[model samples]
Target: MSTINCFFNTYQRRLEDLEKKLNRDQLLVADELTSAERELAMEMVHMGLLENIAQRVFVTKQFPINDFLLRQLVLGQGVYTGNTALYLWHLSDAFPYTIQLAVRMGYQVPKQRYLEWTENVQFKQVRQPRLEEDVKKIDVAKTTRKILVYSPERVLVELIKSTETDKELLKAGIQRYLRSPQRNLNQLLMVSKRLKAEKKVQFIMETLL
Candidate 1:
């Protein structure tokens, strides 16, 4: 078969596998699979078709994927690193407990917005971030430096507004974030000044003991 034919076959297998796993009542990836299963699975990943797709599959799976790999998987990857694992390990946060994935800008939001990119998903509904939204970008250093996604000032301001109207729910979410293993307070404060809610921040600051 041609390389193009192999590529099509790869996606055909992937879609089938993904759908099968999603339909399962209780999934246990390691129960029925071993290292051999992973290699075969990787071979069918359309490796030559799209460079990113193969890399994403390998990095996301860590080991080989079988009939059990769920729709949402990834933590040991280089970009996300160990922060997520640390938080989960310590039960420090509620996020990443569920499916959590960030989409690259100028990309369309997917049907499975909380998981992987399925289609045209540019912005996340939960975040609703924008280039024109006066967001402060920060350079997060890792193996090499790269800009990480954030809305800094706007997101906090939005949360504060939500707190006034729905204090119970808003507080719960922010508190949950705070309880997480990794949170940048300095980033939060910097964002605070850029917000239009100076009075709101001041009120909270004054009330804090």
Candidate 2:
């Protein structure tokens, strides 16, 4: 079968799974599903094949999809990462208009193709599995929906690698994260060491604190 045909078939299966499993006529929240289940549901929502009920909240097709729905879909093997994840963790003052996501390197779709399909979201693909503690499911205060996000420590590791290119934004992001109580020194140190950013991480941690 053609790739497009297979893609649509997969989508149809996901839609069927959603209808059979979710069964609710009301707004859907993140707490209701296991991470695996949520991933499946989010793929359909991101594709514009399923309409979301509210910002980051998916409901059945009975509801009309708003433009804002495009910003809320962080689906298909992707996890919120970098500055965007920091923002979701409430460590940054600025709320992003375009969502940033990280997917596994093995993800089938070209990352740029996602932008072509939906301009409100962006994707980055990484090799290897992420540390479990590096990701979390947190509530979206505005819409009462839950979404996946990277921990502050993990976000810092990502930012450190980008410092040469985005120095000002990296400095600002670190400062913002430091100001928040959510910053975990132990985890940050550990992750930084693992990612070979220990020196910079230590400098920022000590200088900022």
Candidate 3:
């Protein structure tokens, strides 16, 4: 079955169970209940008029990004990279529907597995010179939760490496970032050298500056 179908089935079952429990005990003691159980109980109690509590039901959005990322984390850890990282950092205004991610080689998660979960995310393998140290946790815009992403320095190198296909758009993106007072030249230089994209990065910055 598709991932969405499976998740919906689980959700429906949980709601049905919650409804049954609420019916049995109007004053449900949630102190020992699971987080989900407690949340459903509260929603039933506070979300509407007292008469509607018995019929209280909630629906979920179609594959919300937050839920998708949480599931991705459960499957295997990953770091957002490329333009996706730039967008999350607020350096780029373009929003991407398909998020780019990199997972460590040791995770044993096949590239094909992400396809089974959702089409909105793409995954790649992070190779040598790109260790876990290169990634850091940061909040995605407007979200309270945090996610792992490549630092700006590593993101610059990744964009440089993609110049073959990305060409002009990336060049413009890099130029815009360089103009920002927040750009860290030293860190960029260090990571570019490690990624073997120092020369390319130097060339790009020189032309823009």
> Tens-digit lDDT track for model 1 on 1-209?
99999988886776677435424412223323445544544553446321123223332223233211223222111111122222322323443333223433444443443344333222333334433344222332211122233343344455575443345544444555555554455555656766566677556645541
- What overall lDDT goes with each candidate model? 0.39, 0.64, 0.64
Q: RMSD of candidate 1 to the true fold? A: 12.5
- Candidate 3 contains a number of clashing pairs equal to 0
User: After superposition on all CA atoms, what RMSD does each candidate show versus the true structure?
Assistant: 12.5, 10.1, 11.6
Q: How well is each residue in 1-209 modelled by candidate 2, as lDDT tens digits?
A: 99999988886786676666545433454556657557876776888655544334566565433333333353334677776776666666677677677767665654354444346566676777653447777754334444667777888787876743356666777877777677678888898888888998787777767
Q: Return the candidate ranking by lDDT, descending.
A: 3, 2, 1
lDDT of 1 at 127: 33
Over 113-204, each residue of candidate 3 has an lDDT whose tens digit, in order, gives 44444456667776655657578777533434467888877887888887443666576667767877758898888988877888988887
Candidate 2 segments whose C-alpha is farther than 4 A from its true place: 1-25, 28-74, 110-117, 131-133, 141-145
Clashes of 2: 0
Alpha-carbon lDDT of model 2:
0.64
Question: How many clashes in each candidate?
Answer: 9, 0, 0
